[model samples]
Target: MTEIVIETRSGTLAGIGEAGLTRFLGIPYASAARFEAPGPVAAWQGTRAADRFGRQCPQQFGGKVRRDVLESETYGEDCLYLNVFRPEGGSVGPKPVMVWIHGGAFLAGGANAYDASRLAREGDIIVVTINYRIGVLGFVNFADALGLPAIPSNIGLRDQIAALEWVRDTIADFGGDPGKVTICGQSAGSMSVSLLMLSPRARGLFHGAVMQSGAVSLIHDRERSIRDARRYAEALKLDQSRLQRLKTMDIADLMRAQAIVGKQLKNAIPAAPWYDGDVLPASFDEAVATPTAPVPLLAGATRDEVRLFDLMPGDILPTKWDDLKGLLRDQFGPEQTARILATYPRSRKGRIALGSDLTFVMPTRHFAERHARGNPTWFYRFDYAHPLVGAAHGLDLTMFWPFSGLKMALVRGGPDKGRRAELGQRMRSHVAHFVRHGDPGDIWPRYEAESRKVRIYDLADSFAANPEAERYAAWAGRDVEPGRGK
Candidate 1:
């Protein structure tokens, strides 16, 4: 395990650990950002220590406890890096490669959270997990703010592009076929992949994509994104002249500002991708309708995706009940509100399911349907729930990466272990096959206009066309307004 050395343009680095594979951790892709502007990392002479994880960019604490995770790791302005994993006894010939971008809304998450060893080891492919900017430091827009000459909005995406460039140039030495790369991610990461699908800068960077639980439908416009920035600025009390003072402020201070701004707006400002007329020219539906990228795609969502984040449904039930019919009419209109209530009664589980379908599940299906019209598309619905948790949003990540018995351990106390393993194999196989041959395996036919087939992941695997029709029909056929929070 210790004898393997991977040589890249920057130099050779040693990696440890195994999942029946050779795993390399924390290899630099871009130069350390300084003063917040994107820059190039000058080439080095000696073997750089690409053995450890890079510093994950700064972000606010939402729910997950990651303080200890960050304690021993180094982080700084120069934090652009990625990790690679390959099967130990993998065929000597080139292997397919998959690059992963993580999701924490768009405010936080890192490559370190996921260990690609299991995927690389079992699937016999090259697995790369990448780190990118998050929160105000990464996506906050201030292009016209004269005080900050160093900061740039969307540095996070630029970092992702740089990482792909690194893979194109350096991955072959690590036993990967750069030409067969498949870029995949979930939530904001999926949103990132969607943007890259339309980006001229990202063209030819990868041959395929797999998006889980996110799509192009939710990207904020420039005005919306800038409005978020203004909220952040107001939270920090930074005037135009004092805006540059942000770089020197404590990272924690910025994080607090982010949380404050997020709270002050009552969680309204979603500063994700923007239609900058450059990276993303229009909304995802508009772009796809115009025939955006021809790249083969695999896209889907969990059966109850919103359970992980917005678990409580009674919150909405109470907020609108005072003006129940009017608010219901606001959402579904007077004519259709009654129909919606009839379809999804206010039971303990009904509202939660409705919320999930409205926010993540149905939108994802809509995205696939729109894209399938123009490109080869595959759709899936993950419904295998753990005993305590339903088929939640992040469960697929646990199976695909299968890391330190962490998430799997927490969720495996029931009779679902065998089912989990089966689903893991089937899903991983589809992902690996997609990376290699631009297809998601033989589980189901490619989504077509007439057939509309989708591979469903439950206690057992099955095939159907738009299997969530009941929920989808309730949402689509009826005139429900988009989720206000989304």
Candidate 2:
């Protein structure tokens, strides 16, 4: 391996050359204190070695040890880093850029978990993976709860905007076209991308967006945000008199408080992005009706998103019928809830369908419908089933890049492995095309209001016009308040 140096506005970075790509890891995009907006990174004197992954943002282990959690034990509060991957001698000038944001339910995820080398080389595009603050440090609205006007409401989203600003300012040096940047993410990250489309501050940073299994559905309203902050402060034993102690407290103590608050609110993420009028729209209705940034969009959800929740402990989603009913009723009320419930059968399948549609499917399709009204939008459904869990919540993730052996086996354990690999390639090709030309090629038709065509990704791919129209009809007029019930 050899070193490749690139000069940026901040300083010089030395990346390592791998098999067929050059990788620059652990590049700091911005820096921030506990609850403040991100600030510019301080310039360095000499060339900085960026050969290794950076520390993940400090987060709580949510009752279960998963793959990303085990990958690294070292984490810190100052964890605003990103990574870049570019193909070796692929194109003459700048290539289309794809920026990836990972999803951990707005709580626990990092940038180092993903390796974008293969995606970059095969697609002939530059891929950037980023990290931002999560959990209490990022999402909680301490600004209002503690009368601390200096703290920001959406620090996590601010980190994302800062990272995008860094990309816009510095990507050209890394053979990336900042003008053709496409933002892609899954779950909470996907929600961030969708929310960014509505954020005035994030307007020209991206030209395209791809959301997988998420949209702006799980965000907290202002009351919920402030209530959560109070709960967090109470868990930390910090009243207004002791508010100053929060910044100096150990990160472990904060994590423990986060975990405690998470357990208290069963079947829900304790902290999430709130509708702050500054960074985000002031109200849920305004956010929903706000015209999104004029960018081509490719968004979709898997067939059985809720099934994966059953296998995990401490379910973030409502897996039981009563819990799902309460949540929908909490937002949609009795009559609308009854209309939605009448569409499905009363069984395990019905529970999965109800929860999946309520949590992921309907919200994603709703966003696509709104986006398609003014901009180019392509919608899809991932139908490739896992041997054990069917087409689960994160099944689309495995198709995009190579994962660990255990994850691959658990998701792709059944027959037709070769065909599944081929399907993954097709999906990536569509994404690469979208990143280049702002469309996912001609084969996948645009989602229109009349037909509502959707591309279905399965062992044998096909197209459908308005699949599950009945369920969509049920959720048509309902503008349910997001993050109402646990």
Candidate 3:
């Protein structure tokens, strides 16, 4: 391994070259206070060491995060770092770039969790993974509830946008093409990509996108957002007059308050992006009706998206039939809710299907369908069932990076380990192609409303025309009205 230095708009960074890749880790892209929007990083006087990862955003210890990531990462308030991986001795010309946003249901993840080495080396592209504020510090909106005008809504999204801006102004120095950047994510990260497509501030920052296992169904509506904020304030024993004290409180104190609110909501996400009209559309209905950024999109979900959550504690998703029914009733009319519920049986399999479709699958399909109307679009479903969980959520992440033995076993186990590895390679190839050419190659056909073409990834990759048509029909016109999970 040897040390290499590259100059950027901020300063010179000393990265390392190791095993056929050049790694620049923990490069700060932006800075911000507790609730303010992200701002530019200060210019450094000398070459800053980019050999190790920066501290992650302050968050809770466990809950939905990978065990390895939870053990390895450290957290702090000033965590606005990004990592860049470039293939060693690749084309001298500028290469396509992919910016990855890690997902933890908008609360528990950091950029260090994902290593983009294989993606950069095999795809011959520069891959950038970013860290954004999560949990109460970044996501919980306090602008309106506490009468704090300076506190911005969706600071996490703002951090992501800042990272992209840094990439646009500085990536070319690392042999990356600014115009060919593709933003990609999984779960909450995927939802972030969807919202960014609809965000006016994110226009022109990315040329394409790939969403895995999530969309806009999980955002908080205005009423729910303010309600949750008030709950947090009460948990912290703060009011509008004491709101400014939030900046000076201990991180542990804030986390304890967040936990209090989480238990109160019982299964609903305590912190998530809300449609504040500044960073997002005015309301959930307006967001659905608004046209997204006219960029090529590739998005999909797993066959059994909710199964993983079923094994875990808490109803982070509506895994029970009754829970799913109540959420549907909250969103749709009595007649429409009954009609949708009648489509599924009362058995275990039926409940799993209902939870998966309503929470992740259908929302992904909705985004893809809307995007296909004008811009280029490709949709897919991961059908390679896990031995125990049957292709659960976060399974796609294993297909992209080289995970630890325990992590890989979650999705790549059973008697077909070799076959699953091959499947991962194919999926990565398609994603790289999409990032490069604004399409996932010619083999995977573009998604159109008339055809609804979808690529199914399994032991043997195949194409299907609108898989699960009945379920799609049942959810045809219904939309998730983000609110308090009553």
Candidate 4:
């Protein structure tokens, strides 16, 4: 085993060099007090071991503990850290960099959940995975509700920006090109990517972006944020006027309160990034209409994005015709609901199809159409499905990181390891090409409103022109309220 030591802006990190890649894990980018904005890490006196993973930001992983929770035994408030993976030998020229943000409904995941060694080795690019605060401590806008006008909003996003800033300033020492950075994520992390695109603070941090199964529609407004925070405070049995007590409360007490409020809200994860008028603009539609940064984008969704919700222990999915109609009425009103119902059948499969299109497919297509007008963009649909789960919400992650072993068993299925590996290589190749070059090569054509061409990834990958045009037309110009769809 070879040990490598490199100097960063914060300190000297000792990492491992093997398999033609150098990995430095758990390096702090910033530090912060609870609910406060993050600040740069002070320089350390001596070399710090980056061999073991750092503590994950405090979170509750539903009933079952996730891999991230098991990997890192420690969890606490001071959890702003990032990991770096680059080619082993220093290249003559700087390689492209890919920074990944994880997804856990803005509640549960961390940087340790991902292993980017395959991407770094195969793509010959530097990969960085980061941890940011989540849940009430990270989001929960308290500026106006608590009368504490000085409290910072969107501390999670601030942490992400600080990590990006660290990458821009020090990535060169690890053989990465800071100017050629690509930020990508899935689910809530994907929402963060879109929000970052609209954020002035994250303006020049990355050159390109990739979003999977999420868009700007998930962001909450100030009014909703205040309501959620007040609800959380009430769940804790704390006086709303005495908000200072929350800052010093036990972390376990806060998490229990969060769980209670989350149950009351009928949401598994209650808190998320919100439009603060500073980091994010007032209107997502308006922001997308007139984009500030015309960066290259690779955006797409799985064919049955919402089917994964069926596996959860709840009545979340619509099982019957009446349930489906009720949901449509709530989302699109009676007039549009009648039209949507007429377009599809009244069965379980029909409901799943409608819910999938309404929540994930349509939003992604709309964003791709608007973004492609001024930027180099590519759109795709993942059609590979498991026998039981189908092409669900997180199936794309298995393909993006194929060598994840048993972590991907739920999606990959049995006796088809070879086929899964082939598909994964194909998808990763396209991503690697897009990261190094601005476009996704000549095989996949650029998406335009006139053509509406989309790459379909399945057993046999092919290009199609608006395959679901009729279904998409049903949702034309219709805007669902934020947080209602998910």
Candidate 5:
């Protein structure tokens, strides 16, 4: 087996690797007990086996996540680890590093789904993916449980910070630059990026950030989060004094509680990462709207983000249009609804566009342009459809990382195989170049107010500075609910 050594705060750890890239997996960054506080990783002697992936945080099973990832064990309250990827042979001085934070709505997800081999090999960028605590163990604040002070809510985010500290200290030995680290994530990972921008604990961990489809609009005030916490405690059937007992409960019980709380909350409020008046201070919207912290940002969204997930049955597409019309009237009232209907019209195209625009693309561009005033911001719209998926959510990641072979299943015996493959090469090139250098190159210009430039990636033709001002303006100040794109 090929092997390499890196010195961590604990000790020197030797990680075995393969021909393509050197990957260090299951490296502990922080240690936390169930319902306890996380501080730092425990010091170890000699070396640890980082050859295998660490445990992923627990979540509800049976979904779109890969089977390889699903087969991984669930480590509740004990899921703080990061994986490092380095090219086979590289100089150590200052290689670009991209630290990835996985997204699962702050409740269910892990980092193992992403394979950084291609990014490390092709992009020549060292990639580190980390796992943080999720659900109640990571969140769900029970006030003064067992005579402790207000429990830290967003322990998951703190895990990310700890992993970055590990990266800062150890990545140099793995042929990565500690100073040139760039943090990039999609969906919940993007939300984490936005929240990290506001967190004092996360400052200086990374220099630049790329937020893809970060819908930070769905957050609650501190009072509201605390209120939700009380309800979660009630569901757990734990008295204020015996809240410590939760730590001793079975891991399955914890998962059940998480699912229950998740279902109950639904769209009421996010159960994790509250505006704790300390960790998060205020909601992300408030932080970005008022020009709080200044950080370089590249944020964007896919064109048909919602069509990928159809909550309703396919048979009801016809009758659903009537309900959509009524929803339009209820949201905007008679006159604006009429105007909206006139503007978008009632059709299959209208329905898909409205959902996709409001749910993802609009919020994405709005967050970018609004923050552009105070920070160096670049925006992109991924109109590049996968022919079948039609530019859906999480599609671009397969092209960027080129792992797990999931996206390959979307295509079959087709004469257009080589053309799609070539276009995918271009996508990887663009993303890798962006991660290595702060710019996405001449094909995608730096977004500025004077010229709301955008890079459109598609199979037919690709170009930069293509603005979606109409979509952006319509959903700019809307309430971020369903059908608000109308």
Candidate 6:
């Protein structure tokens, strides 16, 4: 095996080179105590082996679907590490960098799950995937609610910022152009990209962004976040006054308490980024209305973003037309519900479409629309779905990283295997183009208010003017219901 050594700000790292690509895995960007902001990693004299993936942040597998993807990996608290993949050959100048953040509803997933060698080779760019704290340890708001100044809020986001800071300071040694860095993510990670776009701490860290199947609507209000923290504390049998006990609690106990609280709240853990007013603005609307960084963005969602959740065993699915209408009324209220129902047909497929739009598609469009007002933006809709599942959530991941053995079956199960591979390559090429240049090539038009065009990705990829325009119009200027946006 070919091995190479590179010097970074923290220390000297030894990595392996293969297939015209070099990989540095599990390099620490920063170190931090539990529930504290990340601090710089101290320089070490000896070269550290970055051959294996770092331990994933402590997490639990929630269901079969999650188990299928996350259960095989080991996890731990000291998970603030990132992996770097770059072309082996030297270039005249540094290449563009793409930092990826994984998605698992802010509860599960880590950097190890993704292999960036293909993206690095194909795009001829540097790829960095990060591992950050998730669930209670990362997102629970305890500083203000419990009156504990020691407990830092939004530590997960802080970890991401620390990783970006590392890239800004050290990527040049690895042949990456930090000045042209692009931050990309899916689901919760996409939400993170949007939040970082507005975060003062994340300013100048990245020049562009790509958000897939997520948007700015996932953030919770401080009140809601504090309440969830209280519930978590109660599950741990600790009062607000005894919050210090959490610092010394066993990792197993902490995870068990998190699971208990998650179950009690019907899996609605309040463990998400919140509007701290300092780190994040009050609302997504406000943040996008006046962006702190007006960087070009590529954002969109799949045709069935919520079908993945619905496929799980739950009584949440509507049985009939009346049940669907009632569900809509309960979520959007009577007046807006009437408008939505009028715009959408009353059938199982139609209900699923509505759910997809409310949860992922519409929020993405809203953020894209507001962001387009100032900066260049491109939007897309992933329409290809495997025969087994129809355009489900996270299905687009198969297109981005098709070589992954874990995802190959999911992408190749449908008819025409060769055709699917070709499509996946096309999608990756588009992403590579976006990372190299701000635009997504000439075929995809920049989103504008006058022409709400979107690139549709299917067997026959094409551009369309305002796909599902009328349905989106129904929810315009209306307050999107809570829980529906997730």
lDDT of each: 0.70, 0.86, 0.85, 0.78, 0.66, 0.79
As for model 6, its CA RMSD to the true structure in angstroms is: 3.2
RMSD of each: 3.8, 2.3, 2.4, 2.7, 4.5, 3.2
> What is the C-alpha lDDT profile of model 1 across 80-190, one tens digit per residue?
878887787766789988999999877767888887776776678898999887766677765643345446557678788888888898888887888888999998898
lDDT of 2 by residue, 1-486 (tens): 999999988899999997889999999999988877999999998999989988888776585323333224457776899999988886688999999999999888888878888788888899999999998889998888878887887999999999999999999999899999999999998999999999999999999999998888678888888888888888887876665688878666777777787887767787899998999998888888899999999999998998888887786777788988887788778998898999989998888888788788888999999999989999999998877788889888888777767656566653325887788788888988898889998578899999999999998899999999998999983544447522
Best candidate, lDDT: 2
Candidate 6 C-alpha lDDT tens digits along 270-291: 4788877777886555665656
Badly placed stretches (over 4 Å) of model 6 are: 63-73, 313-333, 406-417, 477-486
lDDT per residue (tens digit) for residues 1-486 in model 3: 999899988899999999889999999999888888899888999899999999888777334333233223566887999999999776678999999999998878788878889888888889999999998888887878788877888899999999999999999989899999999999999999999999999999999999998888788887888889889988898877776689888777788787778877755888989888988998878888989999999999998899988987766667777778887887786887887878888898888888898888888899889888898899999988877788889877777677766645645564225877788788888889888888889578889989888999888988999788877887875666435424
Evaluate residue 120 in candidate 1 and report its C-alpha lDDT on the 0 to 100 scale. Answer: 76
Shift in Å, residue 61, candidate 1: 2.1
Counting clashing residue pairs in each candidate, in order, gives 1, 1, 1, 0, 0, 0
Error of 3 at 107 (Å): 0.9
TM-score, every prediction: 0.87, 0.95, 0.95, 0.93, 0.85, 0.92
lDDT, candidate 5, 1-486, per-residue tens: 687777766877778778868788888887887655567777898878788888887655322223333234645445677888887765545678889988765666788888888767877788899898766667666653333464566667777777888888878777678888878888778878777777777788788888887656544555555665666666678775665576677666655555555455432322566665566765544555544246677888877666655543222111245554665577657775565555555676777777666556766676677777777777777776756657777776655555444335453112224665565677656556767777666556677777888777666545455354554444444534331111
lDDT of 4 by residue, 1-486 (tens): 688998877788899888798899888988888778899788998999989778889886454333343234677787999999887654469999889999878887888878888888877789999999998788877675666766788889989999999989999888789999999889888888888888989999999998888887666766778788777767777554666777877777677766666766542256777777888886554655647467999999998887887676543233345655665688778888887777777666777777677667777778777788789889999999889878988888877774445645755664336777778878777877788887777489988888889999987789999778877777774645445423
Which pairs clash in model 5?
none
TM value for model 2: 0.95
Question: In model 6, where is the ten-residue run with the lowest total lDDT?
Answer: 63-72
Give the worst 10-residue stretch by lDDT in candidate 4: 63-72
Candidate 5 or 3, higher lDDT: 3
Q: If ranked by lDDT, best first, what sequence of candidates would result?
A: 2, 3, 6, 4, 1, 5
